[model samples]
Target: MRPQAAGDLVHLSAPASASLRTRPGLVVHRRRNLSMAPPHVVVRRGLTVTRLEQALVDSWPTLPPAERRAPVIRAVNDWLTTSERLAVALESAPKLVDRGALRTLVARLADGCRSPLEIWGHEHVFTGPGMPAFRRQVPMRLGLRTIYLDMFAERERVNIELDGSTTHGDPRQREIDLRRDALLATIGILVVRFAHRRLVHEIDAVRRETLAILATRRPGVIA
Candidate 1:
């Protein structure tokens, strides 16, 4: 047979060639398409997975080198603005909005706006010039929770049921109302109720009674 070109190597023992082939990664190049990536591998902005991963790794030091407690005041202001809405629109859960914090935030917002008053009506009582008539807000909890009068004022903690004439129209309902008041009283929450006639026809007298109940809780009670 004629001699082969210079690139051709001298024939060696098959065992030697096989041993070299078995060396780690030596045969990898011989296996065509072995280095080709899997289908899940992705490219973005002309960057390959290797390049993207490298970029992310390099940015790691700068990404979390500092700890920051979010600025609550500034966060509220940012949320208040319509322009900033997009910044946090996708952030479904607000970090600062909780029962106590939300109430405090709303109180500040309410103080700045007159519309809140007209919109919520008479029940929407604000802290008067001197009296600390705090707003009623309950802590966020699961399920249908009721806000007792205590949430507003300790004096108002005693539940006072004001019934309409229709309540007395039915004798059975009147008895139920009496029983309800007694039950409430048994619970240690004082119950003083009044008919609609007394409440509407003699509002001043009713007001006096309401004030008296509140007075009992004043700083110096003989108890």
Candidate 2:
């Protein structure tokens, strides 16, 4: 059993049996099939435990709504698991609580959204009518250095970067971003950035601005 952030509760899964007993600080989950295939279960410190993807899906419902997405997102970002594997684990848990939300999140991750801010932008601002289908996490080579774009519109040669809250206050990060943008600009890719605050609070405005920017980038459109 994995150590939780809080509480002494230990969750264990076993094949369905009438002899199972529940006690304080112990949670037993009886399943028709308790045995997991190879690679899905690992022997850790002499105890068998579900892999990261399976454990995430199985424990999704137990976490608070706000806290649930972080672990899954972090796991994916850290290369511990992929969105594809998570989707497979999710399929095994049809009755899981808030399953639809998890599915949506996985879909966004599969689309190359690496952060919560980008996910929010995808769902709220960067989509819908007149918005081009943006390719995300696009790689571009600038000599020896290669950089990945957050969102790229191929036809317009535009890149929209979603800046997090901490980015604005960090001078070093801002300098890095500026230099990166300059490099991208040399290749004719226009970089447009929106901060976390504006993206969340000014949804309609950001969408309008993005559309207008894309329009200006078109072949015959006037700025």
Q: Which candidate is the best by lDDT?
A: 2
TM-score of each: 0.33, 0.90
Residue range 1-223, candidate 1, lDDT tens digits: 1224454333211222233343432221122122225331246576433222222222222222221111222333344332123223213224322324333333443432212221122132222332334333322222353323322334444554445566466989879767655554554556556665665567556666666665675567744
If candidate 1 were superposed on the true structure by all CA atoms, what would the RMSD be?
25.3
Reference-based TM-score, model 2: 0.90
Q: List the candidate 2 regions with Cα displacement exceeding 4 Å.
A: 1-4, 17-20
* Clash number by candidate, in order: 0, 0
| Number of residue pairs clashing in candidate 2, backbone atoms closer than 3 angstroms, sequence gap of 3 or more or interchain | 0
Say which candidate scores most in TM-score: 2
Worst window of 10 by summed lDDT in candidate 1:
61-70
